[model samples]
Target: MKQLKDITVIGVALFAMFFGAGNLIFPPQLGVMSGASWMEAIMGFFTTDVSLSILAIVAVAKSGGSFYSFSSKVSPRFSIVMGIILMLILGPLLALPRTGAVSFEMGIIPLFPSIPQYVFTLVYFGMALLFVINPKGIIDKVAVYLTPLLLLALVSIIVKNMLMPDADFPLTKISNVYAYAFLEGYQTVDALGAVIFSGIILMGLKEKGYTDTSSQVKMMIKSGLVAFSIIGFVYGGLIYLGASGASSIPAGMSRTESFMALVERVFGQYGVWMVAVTVIFACFTTTVGLTTAVAEYFSELTNNKLTYRFNVITITLLSYLLANLGVEQIVLFSGPILGIVYPAILVLVILNLFDKYIHFKGIYSGVVGGTLCFSILMFICESFDSLLVVKDWLLSFPMTTFEMGWLIPAITGGLIASIIYKIKATRTI
Candidate 1:
């Protein structure tokens, strides 16, 4: 009974970290765009949001180390390189900064018409820095306070909307709602967050002296299931809220903005502020976790010459500087970064799990190179309309309409690399 109780609180902390402003904003956008495929879209969203999140706990158990534990399978050098990339990708550059911006847009903006952007940015990041470095009452802080209330308010809105859905539903201009939904889920980066947070949970367990591998595995598994329930409830409610809201919000608003509008309408004045506070707190916690992890990674790599604290301060400042760039700008920048980073990370994850006969050689780099090469080509095609303007030779690849010309090159690269290693028997040498 006590063990089960421990699991509940652990799960709550996991969920709270998972439910940031992006979590709130992403789904409604999906609901709006998912159109007839809302069900499939949300289901797919669940993969990145809920399912992949749970997978993190599972991965931690299997690898028996932090997020980078799986990286050693490829080689320590590759692991460190990949881990650093994942952290920055998940941290201030994208997910962490978005948390503050999203909170301002959804929670604060409606309340005050013209709050200068800098004041909001400074205060928001300040609070995040304070709380992250000095966390209080781990589970209760998030589970009891932020996530549950957010869930309740969201559920009520969605339920009311379902009882009376918008009279007319509008479809997005983009073709293939399911694919769009998948991409929408990709944007949330919840799966990546889960991977990072699992490391946190592992550290938490290790601190409490749950050192036995078998025992730690069991604890992680149970804790992951608990996190799933929280994820499921929140995600489902947000989708419903977005669906209910589609009628009132003008089609002109971007998906992210529309979701914020939906929340404001549903909750009214006080409710909106509550949403803001919740987002700020939730996002803050996640930022701290991400910053700390990255700092620690760099610290270890440099033989602890630079302290973790220094790395945290550096990243937070750099992120704050970038915050002035605003939300849309950040996303625009992330486009190339995400394109390049995501496929490599995905390939690594796949290799980590299913590579019984496979081990990481320097050759894994070949597959990574292949994945990025293709992803980059796809990005160039998406970036420009005319081939004439595409000056760089790297951008001159033949892009197929299948939109997945990258996958072929990545696989081909991985296979060739693997075969070369097998033929040379590099491990023997």
Candidate 2:
């Protein structure tokens, strides 16, 4: 019974941590664009946002609760590379800054139209820095109290909206709703966060006297399921609200504007205040939590060559600068970056999850390499529109039509490596 209680507590905290500002902001627009196919869109969104996140946690726990442990199967150097990339995505460059941006966009600007964007961002991160500097009990307190409040508020909005859906739904503009939704979920970057966050959960388990590897892994999986189930349901509800309300959404409104418009339509003026408060609280906690995680990870990874305080200060300042870039630009900058990193992280997580069954180290290295190269090539082709020849060549690959050109090469690389490993093993025997 006590064990169950602990798991519930941790699970809720994990949910709070993963369900950041992006999670709140992205789905409404996704639903609006997905239109009639919103249900299929939600499934694709769930695959990237929820399933990948949980699996990343499981993979880390199974590998003894560290990014290094799981990624080292590929190579020690590869592990370090993965750690650096994950930290950057979760830290100053993207996720951490996004907290302030989201809060400013959803919370502050709507309420205080005259306030300078940078002023709110500065105040937001300053407060977050204070919490992150100490970083011990702040997250726990927020999780225990703030997270539940946020969940309750979101559920209320969802329930109210669902009970009284808009009379006419809009037609979807997206032809490939499932693929578009899947890519949109990448904007959340929770899968990347999951790989880094597993350590935090595992350490908590160890401190709680659940030191056994199997016990930790089992508990982590359970906790992950608990967390992501809530996240997935919330995402679905938000998407439904967006889809139902799409008919009323003006064509020129930005994603955040669309969401705010949705809220106003559903629950009137009071609903806006309710959502603003919830989003600010949620974004603040998420910022503090992610900043602390990145500081701790990088500090330890550097063998204390850089102090935790230094890392915290550096990341906080960098995030503050980027936060002033405004929510839209920050979100735009994230796509190409995530596009390059996400596939590699997914390949690593999937490979690590099945490490025992697939005993060949070469398979790990080969698949990761293939995935990385192909994903980078695809990203470059997309980024440089002048690369028409490259784009044409890439488009000819299997699954390329789905923007999944990496699949065939990754599988082929793994199979070839596995065969080579088996041959070497047989000869040695």
Candidate 3:
């Protein structure tokens, strides 16, 4: 009974961390486009969003709860560089500001059309700052109370929509719906966020006397399962809700607007209120978690030269400025960056899972380096049309048709590195 209680609390905390304001906005749109193929599309999405996330948490746990430790397998220098980049993407540069942007868009803008976006952003971050500043019971409160409310709101919508299914709308078919959805799932950035957020969970477990390495890893896996279970159910239901009520969504509506349309159709005016409440709590809790995690990381990295309060204030202020850009702009800006970063992140997390068995250091550096080069080339090509020559060559590689051109290179690089490592070992002997 005691063990069950512990896992539940930890699991809810993980859920609150990952289920940001934007999370509610994305899945329904995928459902709308997916139509009859929602199941396959969602499975592909679940692979990157939920499965990779759990693997990341387990990887960090195996590394003794330090994200940097896992990355350091490649090299110390590479670890520091990757560490800074991940913090920025998962912090003020992206995810932190996104929470504020999304909260205003989904929670405040529709209800109060007249208010300036900046005003809501300021207030959103201000509230998050207060919660993070104190740092006591924030995680526990979110896990224990806030997550259930978010779940309740979503469940209510799902159940209601299922009982009285709306008229079917025409399904917009993508050539490869599953692959497209898999690529689109990159926007969630949950896999990267999981690596960043694992520190908070590890900290909680340490406080709760989970000290041994083996125990910490076990707790992380169990808690991750809890988080993913809720995420999968809610994500699927939201997708289904959007699919079932597709007719109500106007053509060319933004993802956020589409979701809101679904809610309004299902629950009428009261649905707007339901969405607002859910967005606020869900976004707010996520903001708190991200701010707390970022602040803790930089503070420790700087050895208290940058105080926790100072780091939190700095991140909050920066996020406030970015939030004013609105949700669409932030998400748009994040795409190219995440596309580049996520490939390396995936390679690192997945390889680290076999850390004990993969004794050769070359395996880490080779695969990650290969992924980084290809993903960056992909980003560059997307940014500059002149790079089409390079892009064309990369697309010739396996899985490139699916926008996953990095996979073959990662495997080949690992194999070559293993051979080199063996040759070097033989020469020394």
Candidate 4:
């Protein structure tokens, strides 16, 4: 009974941590676009978002449950470089500011359009800073109390939508539904969150006396299953709701607007309050978590030269300024950056999972280097008008049609590095 209870708590906490602003906004948009093909689209989205996220937790558990340990298998220098980049992207650069923007747009603007974005963001981050600066039982309490309320609201929305009269799904706007949804899944950023937060979950398990690696991995995987099952249900329901309304919802509506319209359709005027409550609790909890995680990481990295309080203040201020950009623009800006970084992180997660079988250390460097280089090349070519021809030619490369052009380079790089390693070992012998 105690073991089951511990897994349930950790699973709920993990779900709370991952189910934030992006998780809420993206699925409905995918549904709107995919229409009758919503199932295929969601299957692709699940592959990258939920599946990779669960694998990330298992990988971290096997790697001894720390970002540094999980990443350092490639090399210590690579670990620090990768860690800083992950922190920045997950911190002030993209994810943290996004929370404030999402909360304001989804929670505030619909009801209180008079509230200036700058003003709301300032107050939002200010509140988040209070929780982060003096975190105590309140943070845990918020997760325990508010998370269930949020879940109830969401489940109610899903169930209500299901019980309502069905609408016809329009023809899918996308040609390759699966690939488009796979790429769209990058926007959620949960896989990245999973890598960072797995350590926290492992700590929770340790507190429950699951000390050994084998027990820890088993417990973590079970908890992860619990968290993602609920996430998958919510995502599928939201996508279906969006599909049902695709013909009625305006084509030019932003993601937030479309979601708001869906809620309104379900509950009439009362949805305004429901959305407000849902977005506030979801985005605000995420804001506090990201801010504290970023602050603690930098403070420790700098060996107290930059104190935790200093980092908190600086990060909150930066996020506030960026939050004023609003949710749509922040998401557009994040796409290219995530495009470059996500593939590399995915490669690392898969490699680390098979650490025992991989004899050649150079395989890590080769595979990750190949992935990063290919991703950067793709980003650069796509960004430049003059490089259109180059982009076209690169697209002809193997697996580019599937949006995974990095796979071939990654495999080739690993094989070459293994051969080189064997040659060097023979010479040394």
Clashes of each: 0, 0, 0, 0
Q: Model 4 compared with the native: what TM-score?
A: 0.92
Query: Candidate 4 lDDT, tens digit per residue, 1-429?
Result: 987877777787677767886788788888999999999988989988888898988888888887888888789999888889888888888888888988887899888999999999989998888877853443354458667977888898888988888677999998999988887775566878888777667767776789998899888888888888888998998898888888878889988888888888888999898888878877876777677767767876899899989999999999999999987687787768888888888888899889999988889999998898889999999889899997887788887865678898888889888999999999999
lDDT per residue as tens, model 2, 135-222: 4554366567678788887898898888993446667888888888887775566788788777767756776779888899998888
**All candidates in order of lDDT, best leading:** 4, 3, 2, 1
- Badly placed stretches (over 4 Å) of model 1 are 35-37, 47-49, 134-149, 159-176, 268-271, 274-278, 357-363, 377-405, 425-429
List where candidate 3 sits over 4 angstroms from the true fold: 165-172, 332-334
Give per-residue lDDT, candidate 4, residue 59.
Answer: 87
The ten-residue window of minimal lDDT in model 1 covers 395-404
Candidate that scores best on TM-score: 3
Candidate models: Cα lDDT each: 0.66, 0.82, 0.82, 0.83
What stretches of model 2 exceed 4 Å from their correct place? 34-37, 165-167, 170-183, 186-188, 331-334, 383-386, 426-429
Off by over 4 Å in 4: 134-139, 206-212, 303-305, 328-335
Please report, as a residue range, the 10-residue window in candidate 2 with the lowest summed lDDT: 134-143
Measured with C-alpha atoms, the lDDT of residue 171 in candidate 1 is 61
lDDT (tens digit, per residue) of candidate 3 on 166-218: 45746655667788778667657688878887888888787777888888888
Query: What TM-score quantifies how close candidate 3 is to the native fold?
Result: 0.94
On TM-score, the stronger of 1 and 4 is 4
